[model samples]
Target: MVKVATYFAMTFGAFLFWQSMDRVHVWIALHQDEKKERMEREQEIKRMQAELMAQAKESES
Candidate 1:
């Protein structure tokens, strides 16, 4: 009876560990996606600023 109880406890622990790892993986994936989007937006803003600068230079010429 003790052996059976030990096995059950181990199995339950493994299941809980797996669930926690899955949640961690999901959070990491979401964070990476958000970081990528932020980087893309920054690049776009830089591109727009460069275009405006070029236009200003042309108008001055």
Candidate 2:
């Protein structure tokens, strides 16, 4: 009976550990995706600003 209980405890602990690890992986993935999106947005903003500057110089001439 004690052996059976020990086996169950071990299995339960493994299951819990696996679930936590899965959650950590998901969080990391989401954080990376957000970082990528932010960088893209920054690039776009820089591009637009450069375009505006070019147009202004052309109009002045």
Candidate 3:
């Protein structure tokens, strides 16, 4: 009976560890995706600014 209880305890501990690791992986993935989106937005803003500058230069000419 004691051996069975020990095995059960070990299994439960391993299961919990695996679940925590899975959560950590998900969080990392979400963070990376957010970073990528932010970079893309910055690139878009830069492109728009360049276009506006070109338009202004043409008007001045």
Best by TM-score: 1
CA lDDT, every prediction? Answer: 1.00, 1.00, 1.00
Across 25-48, the per-residue lDDT of candidate 2 in tens digits comes to: 999999999999999999999999
List clashing residue pairs in candidate 1. none
CA lDDT, candidate 2, residue 45: 100
Please estimate how well model 3 matches the true structure, expressed as its whole-model Cα lDDT. 1.00
lDDT of 2 at 22: 100
Off by over 4 Å in 1: none
Roughly what TM-score does model 2 have, to 2 decimal places?
A: 0.93
Give the per-residue lDDT digits (tens) of candidate 1, residues 1-61: 9999999999999999999999999999999999999999999999999999999999999
Who is ahead in TM-score, 1 or 3? 1
Residue pairs with clashing backbones, model 3: none
Evaluate residue 15 in candidate 2 and report its C-alpha lDDT on the 0 to 100 scale.
Answer: 100
| lDDT for 28 (candidate 1) | 100
Model 2 local distance difference test score: 1.00
List, residue by residue over 1-61, the lDDT tens digit for candidate 3.
Answer: 9999999999999999999999999999999999999999999999999999999999999
